[model samples]
Target: MYSTIFSHVGKYKKEAYLSPLTIVGEVLMEVLIPMVMGLIIDHGIRKGNIGYVAGMGGLMAVMSVCSLCFGALAARFSAVAAMGFAKNLRSALFRKVQGFSFANVDKFSTASLTTRLTTDVTNVQNAFMMFIRMAFRSPIMLVCATIMAVRQNRRLSVVFLFAIPVLAFAVFFIISKAHPRFEKMLKKYDEMNGKIQENLVGIRVVKAFAREEDEKKSFGENTNSVRLAQFAAEKLVVMNMPIMQLVMYASITAILYFGGHMAVNGNIETGELSSFIMYVSQILMSLMMLSMLFIMFVISRASLQRIYEVLAEEPTITAPEGAGARARDGSVRFENVSFSYYDDMGNLALDHIDLDIHSGETIGIIGGTGSSKTSLVQLIPRLYDATEGKVFVGGHDVREYSLDTLRSQVAMVLQKNVLFSGTIRDNLRWGDENATDEEIIEACRSACAHDFIMSFPKGYDTDLGQGGVNVSGGQKQRLCIARALLKRPRIIILDDSTSAVDTATDSSIRKAFREKLADTTTIIIAQRITSVMDADRIIVMDGGRITDIGTHRELMQSSEIYREVYDSQQKGDDE
Candidate 1:
């Protein structure tokens, strides 16, 4: 666990090492001050020597000053380390989430990822800071206090021995109980996040259907469950105070009773007994720190396990060796291809698919929902591997080429794509980092996004809200296309990309694609038969199989499914 956390903590090791050094120094000073007080009382006051008393008192004052300064410095270092580690860990986790495949993302929803990257990371950071700042200090004080108490009087040290077992037992019981509670509480937290996220993402549908009450009630149940779990864990932690107070009160009573008897009988001096009382207080305080740290351990252990889960999952689609470079003209083929998501008689997402996409051919794929249209094209980029047959790009098996090299040759506009919260220019540059102003404008033109973008007050520099929430659906889709256009990849896949645009605008975008991207191999996935009606060739799919592979007129004459679809559309057009 420690190794996993230190790895994610990226670039903070120097700060971590520096923070502990300050805490160790503070611990040393803190122990020395009490010892100084003991010597001042025993030698200076008893000798009736004014000089020795004043000198020792001044030295004690100096140690107190040093302790205050160093303790404050140690606290500053710890705060710096905690905040820095939290920031870096959250950043790295976000990067990991970005790189994860669709299957990995499906394992945890958006809200759950947010909570893990945020709340869980903060919990671990707090635990780490507490451990570094106080864990070491407490142990050092405990050991030194014990030695000082024993040296002053061995009988007094016996009180400490009795108290340690009680303290240990109390900590053990609370932590063992609380550890399971913390894990349970975090699970409930994830559940609550998942529900709330679902409600928010589909809030429009909920409101449209007047199901707000039902949604609220559903959310409330998860929320209440989380509240109860948190309350239970907190209630357990709260017991620490009262339990430690009992130990503190009992230890004090034992000290006063035994030390007073010793002082009265002259078995121990009055000064020595007074000094032992002070050390006993320090000992109890250190035990309190220990108990609090145990509680921290319970919480952090749960959080750390959650963090390690993400770090440990290796991406299944690894880039193959000797596959760094991609060919300039990207040719793709599916040789008797079949793909399934699961092993046991699952519905084939794509079945016995075969096709050859020449380097610069403008191909279109049209199908109804669940036709395996997107799945077939997605394999070319190696987003998902074929289960039973080969998918080749650039004349090599896609799995044989590096995932990155294959992807670099392909630019795809997904069905439901997102835009980050940044300027429009930033979103476009994600496709090609070195794109010039003219290139961006030219790509935007081909995507039919330039006019809409220029109409905005800030034009290309306009800030898009999260997922481009401020933009309309059509605008967002066009921007996604513009992003793909900026890359100018040898192969482009338009996955129902023009669905949001008007028919006239869709035609205009296609015309622009022909004019500007003449030499580019383009695959258009469309549900509207009109979008791909004029392609050089169209592959028509039904269920998961390609039923027709020809130009529109050829398919109309040869394939029953295509004829039926074309006849239905012609009737709709007549209506």
Candidate 2:
């Protein structure tokens, strides 16, 4: 775990090393100050030697300044190192997540990943800063101060030996109990963030249904769970300071009592006794710092594990070695292709599907809900690989081609349209980064989105709010269609992408596809019979199987499922 996490401390190695080394200098100065004070008290003040007192006092002032400077430098370096480490770690994690297939993303929820990238990384960053500074300083200070005290008078230093074990035990016990609670608290944080995301995304729906109070109650419950877990973990950590103080005061009292008697009996000098007391404080304070560092480590251990899990995950979908670089054409073939989200044949989403689609062929697929309409098209782009059989695009197995090459030729407008927070022109540029304004306008016209866009004050430059919240559903769908059209892909799959538009506009968009994209393979997945009536061929799907395949006239006479759906739709339109 240490090696995995510290590997991201790439460019910050200089600051990482410098922080601890400067801290060592600071600790050395701190340990030496008490010794100089002892010299001033014994050889300078007691003997009425003004020159010696003045000289030692000057040395003490210089050491104090150096200690301060070292401490400031350590803080600067450690902060830089910790921040840089976190930046690199976050970048690596994001890159890994981007590489994950849809199946891999399903294993980890969006909310959980968000929490790990943010709160978990922040926790580890803070712990690393503390480790470089206090973790290094405390142990060295403890050992050095103990040695100095033992050298001054070995008998008086025995008091620290007894205090150390008791304090260490208390710290260990608290940390062991608190670690699991912090882990639980982080999970609760994920839950809370999930609730907040859902509530915000569906705020309009919640208000429309008058379910605001229910949402509030649910959010409150999540927050309360997080609060309780945090309280439990912190309650244990809060005990560290008081226990440290108790051990500290008890050791100081024992030192003064026993050493005063030794001084009176001429066994230890007053100056040496004073130095021993200072060393005792230093030793106990170092223990306190160690306990704090241990507590931080205990809290950050959970975060480290979460981050490591992300870094270690290999993307389930990756190009093979020496994979083909490009696709030859838009033709797609599913040779006994079967797919299941769970990778179990019993739960197959597309069962043993076999079909051949030629380049520039406009195919229509009409299916009821749960018939896996979206699942079928998703395979063409290699979004999710077929569980059992081959999915070929351009006569090459999709796996044989690099992902960038295969996906760039296959553009899809999914059932749920998504748009980022950017200007309309900026969003459209995602399809073709260097597309000219005339080309963008032409694509929008084909998608039936050009007129609506022109109505807006900023036209193409209008900003679409996050997820395109500012636009109506139909308008958003049209914009998404425009973005995909701009790609000018060989194969464009519109999976129920026109559901939000009226029939007239949908028909016009289909006409535009036929006239403008004569050479592009167009696959339309629709629920309405009219949407697919004019296609070269229409596929009727039921229960994850292709029940019938034929043209509109042939299916109307031969396929009962297609005839029934078309008749019902016609009857509904008459009503």
Candidate 3:
């Protein structure tokens, strides 16, 4: 896990190296200052040698300045390295998510992914920064101070033996107990974020149902769970400070009592005893810093695991070696194709289906809900691979072509039309980035979206709010159709895209498709009989199977399902 995450510290390696090196320099300078002060007190002040005192004091001042400079430089470098590490990590995660196929994406919830990318990465970054600085400095300071204390008098330094064990045991116990609590807290964070995202995305429906109180209650419960978990983890961490202080004070008392007797017997100088006490303080303080570092590592361990989980996941779909670069034409063929979202053959979403669509044919598919109408057309673009048989697009197996090459030639306006937060032209450019203004205008006209778009104050430059909230449902659908039209793909699948528009507008859009996209294979999935009645061929689907396929006139006389639906719709139109 460490290897995978730290590999992203590429350009920041220089900063990572410099941060610890500078911290070492600062620690060394600090260690020497106390020894120099002891010399001035014992040798200079006792012997009334003013010159020695003055010289040593000047050296101490220089050392303090050097220590300060090293510390400042260490802080700067550590910050740079940590921030750069986080940047690289987030970019890598986003790129990885973009590569994931629909099956891969289904494994992770959107909220969980968001939390891992943000909160989890931030936790790891902070832990890394602390590790490079304090983790390096603490051990060096502890060793240096312990050596200096032993040099003053070995008998007094023995007190640290007992105190160190007690502190170590306390730190270990607290961390071992707290780690699981922190892990639980992070999961609660994911839950809370999921709630927030759901509420915001469906705020309109939420308010319409007057469920604001219920939403608040749900959110409060999630927040309370997070709070309780955080409190449990922090309560253990807070115990560390008091345990450290108790050990430090007891060690100091033992040192003072024993050293005072040695000073009186003239075995150890007063200056040396004072310096020994200072070293004792430094040693314990270093140990305390080490404990804090350990605690941070324990907390970040959960985050690191989450991050690695995402990085380790191999994409379920990958382009084959020597894959074809371009599709041959708009023709699509499904040979005994079957699919199940859960990979369970017993619960198939698309049953064994055999169908062939010729190039430049306008095929209309009509089906009731749960008939897998959308699922059938989704296979053409290779959104989901067939579970059983082969699906061929443009005369080659769909997997035989590169994903980009195949998807580029087959444009689909999905059932749930989506538009991003951008100007009208910006959203339209998603279909064709380099399309000219004239081409964009023409596509909108073909989709019957040009009149409404021009009515806006800024026309193509008008900003659509997030999820295109600025427009009505019908307008959003029309704009999506326009965006798909901009692709000018060889095979265009409209998955009930015109359901929101009036029948007259829908007819106009279809007429425009007949004139402008005569040579393109157009597939329309709709509920309205009128929508598909004019098509060259119509398909009737039920229970994930194609029940019949014929033209409107042929189905009216032959297919009972089509006849019943058309007659009922015509009777309702007369009323």
- Candidate 2 C-alpha lDDT tens digits along 20-109: 999999999999999999999999999999999999999999999999999999999999999999999999999999999998888888
Model 1, residue 331: C-alpha shift (Å) = 2.4
Give me the runs in candidate 1 sitting further than 4 Å from their true place.
8-11, 39-52, 199-215, 343-347, 573-575
Instruction: Extract clashing residue pairs from model 2.
Output: none
Model 1, total clashes: 0
- lDDT of all the models against the reference? 0.84, 0.93, 0.93
lDDT assessment of candidate 1: 0.84
Per-residue lDDT of 216 in model 1: 82
Better of 1 and 3 by lDDT: 3
- lDDT tens readout by residue for model 1, 131-172: 877788888888887787788888778877778888889889
Select the stronger candidate by TM-score from 2 and 3: 2
Q: Candidate 1, residue 57: CA error in Å?
A: 2.1
Off by over 4 Å in 3: 571-575
TM-scores vs. true structure, each candidate: 0.92, 0.97, 0.96
lDDT-wise, the better of 1 and 2 is 2
| Candidate of highest TM-score | 2
lDDT by residue for model 3 over 330-418, one digit each (tens)? 89899999999888999999999999999899999998899999999988887887888988888888888888888889999999999
TM-score for candidate 3 = 0.96
Q: Candidate 2 local accuracy as lDDT?
A: 0.93
Question: Clashing residue pairs, candidate 1?
Answer: none
